[model samples]
Target chain A: MDSIFAIPLISAIVSIAGNLAVFRKASFLIAGVAHSALAGVALAIFLASISIELDYFLVATLFAIFFALLATTFSKFSDIDTGIGVSFALAMAIAVILISLTRGYTAKLWAFLFGELFLMTEKDFLYISIALVAILLIFGFFYDKLIFFLFDPEGAEASGINTRLIDAIVVAIVAIAVVAVIRAVGAILAYSIFVAPSAVAKKFSKSVAQSLIYSFLITLICLILGLIVSSAIPISASAISAFIASIIYLLVAIEKS
Target chain B: MAIEAKDLSYSYGKTIALENLSFKIDDGEIIAILGPNGAGKTTLLKCILGLLRANGEISVLGRDPRKDKKVLNMISYVPQRSSLSIDLPIKVLDVLKMTCKEIDSEILRHLELENKLDLLFRELSGGFQQRVLIARALMKRPKVLLLDEPFNGVDVLSQKRIVEVLERSGATTLVVVHNINPVLHAVHRVMLLNKKLVAFGKANEVFRRENMVKVYGAEIPLVVCEEGVVHPLYGDQHG
Candidate 1:
């Protein structure tokens, strides 16, 4: 039980870091790729693992590396015909069905879906803190390259910008982040923390730099509030944060329109 | 260095798009590529742009366009108007604006589209969309402007306006025009293509009735009756 919990919880920790990335205008595909990989592992454990080992940090590290590799590879083919959107959606669907079929053996499946961030534990929180620092450093270093790609991919490529390499690296981050978030909010909802804040922030900014700045600030606020709300009110941290994010996006959209 | 193509050839699958095409575009000279339907005119431009692969050495501004980003950045391309996505929620000004260090109002005024920046690109007429694209290309301040069938579905007035803009762009402009009359006097050099180099020289010298008959597969009849002399029925059938 602890091992199963370990995989998702550590993933949720990384999810926070990846979610931080969306503030810098990373593509939604990265988040999806990351979530899909975690969902694959969670689905596997739900069906086969009779005993849980949530304390295995090495298992989390291996999953991060594996998911990151998949993400990097997928971004290169993101331009291909229907491979990005179609295949990923189908994979997510298959994961849902497999989890549903295994429902009789493990009611903890639903717990994984909603996440138990309230139980992120002192150790998991420490891991999350370290992951956030790493994410911040990476984001700071590659901020210019990432911003340029989003605005004009063709122009950037024509200018001989190494967009393909940047794209692949972003994928790696997404895969790792999705795994991190899986422990708290599950696979499907992890995307909310990743994409919503940035998308909402874009409604107000004129420049890409401004958009990224606001997106990160918004994400940080949501995380702090989500953690606090879930603690005080006995609700899922992910759900509370997601609800707040959705409302903020709605208000931003409505205010602009 | 002047752009030159020697024994240049290209193909798309089994069908031949260009065969042994050869010509030289002198420095600072505007050359208009003239042809009818299926004339392989675009293939030649694509070769120059390095969008399509070809046999034989083709040099643009002395550098291979395929491997040269500096050339690509220096060369302005006005792709076919229809190739652009119309309903992308992008604004006219948004498309026109680029990595140019400075944004000047004079460029928009010259194109006579100074006031329509915020309008959605899809909402603009076909002519306006073409102008917007031109503005985008001009944003780079390129030395060579390459246009592929830019006048398609455009009005005569817009055609004249576009021609005037390109002339004033202070660049060696190359245009692909299907009809000759609108651009015959406007263009300096003409490269007639029908899967190969039919003719390449001065517009008036190369676009004569004899050359048109040879390349277009139709002879324009001139009938002198009583007190009147009738020229080719459809004006200038070839350019």
Candidate 2:
């Protein structure tokens, strides 16, 4: 109802939809992209202190996209996997820590790292809504092709699908989703939303479409429950959402066992 | 020619997988490519399908496969079983529906997979998975069909059914097999390869003692039966 609730709802939608597109392996890429956003934030803060007056969201989105693209492209061209590209995240983490120490902006850095959803501005709400719409449209249009590629890449390519282009688009969607929700879920907690809900859905679903629907429902439940719990107690909403996701995953695993 | 390759060579870094390979397939002909392990059998298929970048030229349906993607629409490729992950949560009918606009009920009935359309692909046995892959390729009504090790894990009955289906399809079919016995009667010609085109002709002409020894690096005794020449080396292993 309120614009404040729109932030969590939109984040849940983006997380569920993005996870459905890339599946669980995408969470690793999200972690890499999210952590890499720290470098962009550091650069933005540095530029702002000198009166350059740039939008931090734009800088962080561009930087995170660059790092995400670099990681995927490097892994594809070389004989390595996406895990090797995660080194960029570690490097950015160190850079952000050093910059915060020297610039005495530790609180600002923590705001990005831990997330503060209560401080979401009207502009942030608009950006999240636009991202959710974009994600919905892209996934809706490419749903079948994406499923084909994910199920069997060789078969998809053999069937005249542009697998490389599709792969790049998938990575771009992931980068955008991470950038859109980084402020609400934080760089550290965002991966849980992308991964845990999908993991639970997979355990209960027999088809890709079913898994997608279940993932959305599970993420929405977790986000709403986390919001309620955090309202009554002194706790982080993002942390509570992550906790709820993990507890659901555990419950599903136990039920399956 | 439905498919033509001129001096097509491919290398994995410094290691050469295929070298100076040249071949042609007539329209509506069935050809089986036989080779030992790492003889570039799969590499040759990938080059023809434009899945790999080769040194020389390859034209499928009179267009360069590497330059033009339109040729891919008329061609269907069934890769080795290893290329597919069985554990994916996808239904048999869903796989067919994704690859083709309409399901060919006749092909499904022939493959005996019509009843198992709703089953998860992973739940099927190895033989059924291969049949499903074949059925998926056939659903496209492709002019040029390429299969890599289609009988790797298939049972004898399914193998016979696949051979019969390919024989009746009338498509330009190129199949790569480790064993040449099952497909000997079905294939119009056979191509033997060991990093190079060793032999290409009728099955009787190519399955000689010297060519078999050259490709397989061992003495392979052939038995002339009512069906055809059976290479004891590969034929009996599956039986």
Candidate 3:
């Protein structure tokens, strides 16, 4: 198995963790978006690099995003906006510099920049499948509680839900998902898997649970089709997935129209 | 008892928001808590909801408020209008759906908000926002409705309308009202407060010029003529 696939699988899990943790706090929306952007930037850097251990680099970036997100979101790191800007800027700048140093900023960078490659190993495929199952299990267990916390904790608490515990469970799920998908989409585009499906689903959802289910189905379709098209057409799975997602969004819009 | 408190004292970094306060609300009575600015009216409401940690014995719906939150859910809280941000990206009808159990189609129609359900919640006026919260509180079918300053910037017509709804609901209502005249007839009793309970009972008994002076200080010049009707001659700003 090519080591690069391992990175995305782990990344997918960790990214999900980060996204889920912030769903309870006041800045959940901001936290989700910022972490997503950071993940995208990191994956872009990896795509630009050569001779780098794909697993090590992906794990480092995941840790960096998780640590930075938690420190900035949970703690008062000189205010939220300032902390997000500074942390994200530093991480992206460092990753970009490293990528440039390796490749001298040539057109070859586009392969990584725009997701123009699809290389996978047997182990990576297995890991991703297992990670996907784990993600489903975690989500199913905490679905009701997480939905309640996101919408209204006062009501959640009134209904005898341990909001904080439920919030923690969601964080764990997002983290695992982020770790798992890191290779499939990379750091930069990983959140596309986490957020896009949910976002597009929002326009059509009647309830939080429905939106979540819609997002899961949309994600499953993207992963399968993206992997297939990339292997057959010599394109990057990341880019293919994004294109397919956009198509899905368009379909939704057209259907609504 | 529907609600009971004894020696209730709450502190916000030693500021003493509520000081050794004692009060009770019966099973089914509309009580108004009247006080000057900063007189701890809101503090009293929070104390009952257990939102504010207090040093006193408090019970609601036959359970300790600090222990069982389910018992607290039996009570609906209408928080200060100033504390909430309405401009968030949520529809008025959507928020109402989140509040109540069933989201009855007749609720907004009953509150005269049937046409404005699709609008952004933050886009509404202050009166409209309060009404939305009132509708949320009403949806709970709470045994006790604790409203804090619900009528700020409210028009007389809307106030009368709200009073009519509360009067007809038959729930135990505890309201913090600024105006005494309009509520003189609505509430079954009024609690005059000044960091403490100055007096508690029927509005006619507690709305005396002497009690008003005690609660508001000498600054409020109330003209209590020989006929027993009291009129506000000047505004008092004491707490």
Candidate 4:
């Protein structure tokens, strides 16, 4: 419920999930999943307006996971990037339609777009904590196999690693992480946390563990800095955090070049 | 027999990748699968690994690879070195340790990669990368080893080291290569392919001018050395 504790927990989840996304080369895929969550949020709000109760987080998780798997299936017909791109457009289109059908939806939209961390309830924190634990346990247990599959998928499969199960786990992680982070920081800001830290970390990291630690440190810094700066100014913390993340990524890219 | 195929065929939609191809590999024999680009060399290996479902029968170690999930435990694969585009900072030790708990340091020593275990995989030269992959495949002590383009982009010395290791591996190996020259002395038989099994026999018998022309679509010049080994001269491009 407290903004002080919420920032760090969200940062940890985003950093680890973001690092995995970078390794999977699924930044856009994760972004697509986050964007698709808007559809579920809008549908949930629309149902609420009609006197039907539904949890937005629950609906968003389902939507994100569906779109994530759908993108993979579409990849069989085309390249992965194209599949994700198409799925992203479709998700946005559905979101727009759902948004139009809902009345008095601006407050809900604003909450999701810029995040309402200050408005987060005890339930949201519990859900996020559970997600963080699940991510840590699953990724920690399967780190080696995951690395092998990501490094050389064919070789991993031939070596008897259940690659399909790995795929499912990865897809689930990306989808769930995106949905959970979006519910906390909103979709646009969540995208930055899910990608920027990991991208910058990859530039300086010498190994996977180094990359993960660097990513977590960078995300935590941005989140804390955003909170401090937003307190001094009249800006939203989520917006400031996203801006800081992007600026850091730009500086790193420039330095690398 | 270690591997046998009967009327085994596969296609990507209507496009035929392989057709009516059948062959048998003896136990502990090292065979080379040669072809120009898109010759289905990789496809055949995929079939044996059960990575792809094909028409007809393919038996590996007297079991249908497609039906028996356990067959995967007996096989290890080295995909094309150039085909891997990993951005992760995984090390050589990480790769070698993926399949086996205790890596055979002897294999690493043979490949001259024992010291490079700490280096990032992407930091390695093409030759070292190929050697690392081969070493990883060997770590499993697989009954059947499948290597797809194992020597692609490898240095001369690395190539020799790889062949030496493969010869000593003593596994039923199927090495898919663009050209047979690099592994000529090591492999017992050469299976020349171009969308079909053009020739499959002893190197001396299959390395004939007609077979070369039929498969490669050009007359590849061959020179017989003092050891009676036939060497083909031509550029083999990856498809």
Which window of ten consecutive residues has the lowest lDDT sum in model 3 chain A?
A25-34
TM-scores, one per candidate: 0.62, 0.90, 0.61, 0.96
- Per-residue alpha-carbon lDDT of candidate 3 for residues B1-239, written as tens digits (9 for 90 to 100): 68889999888776877787787888889998988888999888877777667898998878877777777668877777665533333567766755465765565666788887877666787778777878877887889888888898877766776777777667899999787655557777889888888999975587677888898887455556465555344454223
* Per-residue lDDT over B78-179 for candidate 1, one digit per residue giving the tens place of the 0 to 100 score: 767654435333466666764454656777887778888877666788888877777777778888778877787877877787777777877877888766
Clashing residue pairs for model 4: none
The C-alpha stretches of model 4 lying farther than 4 A from their native spots are B235-239
| Candidate 4 lDDT tens digits, B1-239 | 99999999999999999998999999999999989888899999999988899998999999998889799888988888655655678878887888887889899999999799999888988899889888988889999999998877788999999999999999999999876778888888889888889999888898899999998888888878778988687754322
Better of 2 and 3 by DockQ: 2
Model 1 residue A196 CA deviation in Å? 3.7
lDDT of 4: 0.85
Could you give the TM-score of chain B for each candidate, in order? 0.88, 0.95, 0.89, 0.95
Q: Candidate 1, residues A1-257: lDDT per residue as tens digits? A: 33333433343333334433543234455445544554565556554654554533334445445544554455456642244455456556755676666646445556546666556665655555555556556667875565444444544444445767766555555555555555665555666766776666555554444555666667556666777786688777778876777788778788878
By summed lDDT, the worst window of 10 consecutive residues in model 2 chain A runs over: A78-87
Clashes of 4: 0
Best by lDDT: 4
Q: State interface RMSD in Å for all models.
A: 5.4, 1.5, 4.9, 1.3
Please write out the lDDT profile of model 2 over residues A29-74, one tens digit for every residue.
Answer: 7677777776777777777766677777787778877887778667
DockQ of candidate 3 relative to the true structure: 0.14
lDDT of 3: 0.63
How high a TM-score does candidate 3 get? 0.61
